[model samples]
Target: MTGLLVKNYGIKKAAKLSGVSEYTLRAWERRYSIIIPFRSESNRRLYSEYDINKLKLLRKLTERGIQISNLSSLSINDLKGLLNRVDSEIISTDEKYLQLYDIASVDKTINDSLEAIKNFNEKKLLLILHRAYKKSNFLEFVENVLFPVMVKIGYQWKSGLLRIAHEHFTSAVIVKFVLKISSEFEIKNKAPKIVITSPDGQHHDFGAIIGDSLAASEGWKSTYLGVSLSAEDIATAVNQTNSHCIFLSIIYPNDNPRMEAQLLELSKSIHDDVVIIAGGNAVTGYKDILTNINAHIVKTPKHFRDTLKSIRNQIRIDKRENYEKKYL
Candidate 1:
């Protein structure tokens, strides 16, 4: 082997130097071919210094909201150029300039996404979402772009400005985009698992799709049981996956007594240790029941994000305690 190929860095060292977890490094390799380390005679992977540096760069960019999918094909020089732009933006202390730059990019994204939806152009809609995803973090993308656009579409559809076909088209496009992005995220096998679904009769599933996508972004292994699932079926899935948490999306048709009973059944069926989170427009109608059952009721998208953070933190604490019990 040439001197340059003297792979001195093992996976742990590479991960340490790159400011990423060993699992994330492996995932990047598998998903994006970001770096394919050499195999030793013993069949163990070994990364060279160059591979370590490249991974470091990728980690920095991805943390700043750039998608790994977009960076996989770029050369080192191209990567550096992008990094330089991010650095420039950070170093500038001029509040006015920063504000304008931020506003322009965000406004453009929202406007373009709305126009694409109005035109019922699925291709353009997906492209716009991709661009937004690249520029903003998942939370920002959902809040500024997805939420606003969906609200506008709903309003127009209800006000007789847009036909039913338009609402259905928009829903399909959004669901497709969310599912595609969720599938792209890689979660460690040992990461906390989550189950996302809407109960039977709650046919509106956009909230459920987005909820699962958000969980996946936080490195949670999410078992997404699509809409219209029975209480027994959801409980079965939770048991099957050994999920740490469950998120239920409750939309219209809020006054159903049967739905209330289903929620109660789910709360009773799942293990007490599992966290239950319920959210959506119709959730308010069952607040008393959810409270009695010790289920979390997220009133808004932002609240849902915050609740997931708490859940992830709890998962970390549980893992640490288990690790101590086993080894320390």
Candidate 2:
């Protein structure tokens, strides 16, 4: 299909539209010849509507772990085919991955939890969550059970499939349970400290709670600061706690006018060494502010875990350096 054939865009516009960086786009054009866009009279590359679509598809596939080299030779139709196989898309992991979480059982648990939420059956919901918690490790439970269930509940509430009360009820239960479970772990003396919270105007705290649990799992002494704290208060808390890092979870209100101001305030208040790790659905809205703060934007749980590991290594290295300098 000839898409927007009359209209063409410059590389920057194409990058913004396609969600691919300009450098990557240039490299793909030069090295891989992924798309030979129209060259203007001044030799500036201009991407057509078709080129933008191709770039967007490429971005989506690459995000899902497909290599650009493998995809370079394929036609746009092939890319769509790879993406459209929703029921049979191939996963990159080994058989052990499949065995890690029994999909059938996890789905059943998710459904059971949803039913309990619908019925407002507190006892049954807690029992189900407890069983899932006992059966799986922290990451597995969060990814396979907790996240999926909460996401569906969110959608249902948004669609008016369920009452606001049900959503609040589920949130209350999960928050308490997660805090209780996370508190069971004894923070080691050497564990890095981190404060997990959502910024002011962001009401959702589930992401912060999960982040707290995950940080604890990664040997970080994470204090769950809850949701909707002003930037100044967060800065004070971080300073008081002497936290090694701050994790901000932005889940809802993707377009708050004050988001940029809040992020800017937080960045100004915190120490430069205090790393800010941001994640969740709404982070994209304040991308420019986050960039200015030098925040690390983690896209997945695995990425978050890897970032934590790197920070921990850096902390140890610093400590060792201090010891050697004192004695040597």
Candidate 3:
């Protein structure tokens, strides 16, 4: 490698250093031409120290409600000055700015996605999803963008604003999108494994998709078994993967008589140490059963993340205790 190339970082390293996803970094370089990276002899993207620093500054600015499009041309000193102003409260109050921007931006994208679905414009729908992915951070993209879009699509389909075909189209796109992005995330060494899916008779896979993706973002090695697997299959998969947790997404058929039995069977089948977490619109209908099995019922997106953190902490505690007993 040339000395100049040796001094730069590769795309993955740059992403790690700057707290950005690989796709979004590529988007900024390609779409905005904000920081064109050097191409290695092997055609790899190599970001110089200057480029990584600029990306960090741009991320902070975007977090504080300054748009990314306006940031590309600013000098390093200018970016630092803006950050200083933000720290000194010269910019709008952080929470207020974030709250307003997050709401408006997420709402607009959701609306646009629905519109594209309504028109059966697959291209436009995909464009919206990609743009949203590029603009939002991991949580905002999955929780605020994808989850709400799924909810709205479901609601609109039931209310006859959109047809079943439109729903299928959206789900197909989301499945592909989720599958692609899931591979892009970097997992931690010896990370906990999680199996994300829904019980038999439940075909709504969006919840599991979201859960699986977010688990990867949380540094979990997630295996997303596509929806509608029976309790026995899910249990076997969990054991086979040696997972630390099971995330069940229950989205419809609130009155499925078999669901209670399935949940009971699942609890009995999984390893005793495995954590069970249940979520989705139909989760409440099985609350009694979930509670009986000691499953964590996460009601909202934030609750889902918080529950993951809690379970991970418990896992750490248990590991420490086991190590102390064995070695200390």
Clash pairs for candidate 2: none
Comparing 1 with 3 on lDDT, the higher-scoring candidate is 3
| Candidate 2 local lDDT, residue 30 | 87
Whole-model alpha-carbon lDDT for candidate 2: 0.79
List TM-score per model, in order: 0.65, 0.67, 0.66
Expressed as tens digits, the lDDT of each residue in 1-328 for candidate 1 is 2665568888866754555556567767899898899999998889987786677678657655689899999877788899889867753222322343355455777668767867888999899888888988887788667766766666678888888888889889988888888888888978888999998989998889999988888888988889989999999999988998899998877787887688889877977567788887788777777755657677556667777786676567657766877999
Q: Tell me the tens digit of each residue's lDDT in model 2 across 1-328.
A: 5766544899877865665656678778888999888888999889988888788778767655578898999898998888667215543222323333345345789889989999999889999999999998888887777766766776678889998999899988998888888888777997899999999998888888888888988889887778999999999999999998999998888898988998888887976567788988777777777755657666556657777886676677657766877998
lDDT on C-alpha atoms for all candidate structures: 0.78, 0.79, 0.78
Q: List the candidates ranked by TM-score, beginning with the highest.
A: 2, 3, 1
* TM-score of candidate 1 against the unseen true structure: 0.65
Candidate 1 stretches greater than 4 Å from native = 1-108, 320-328
RMSD of 2: 10.4
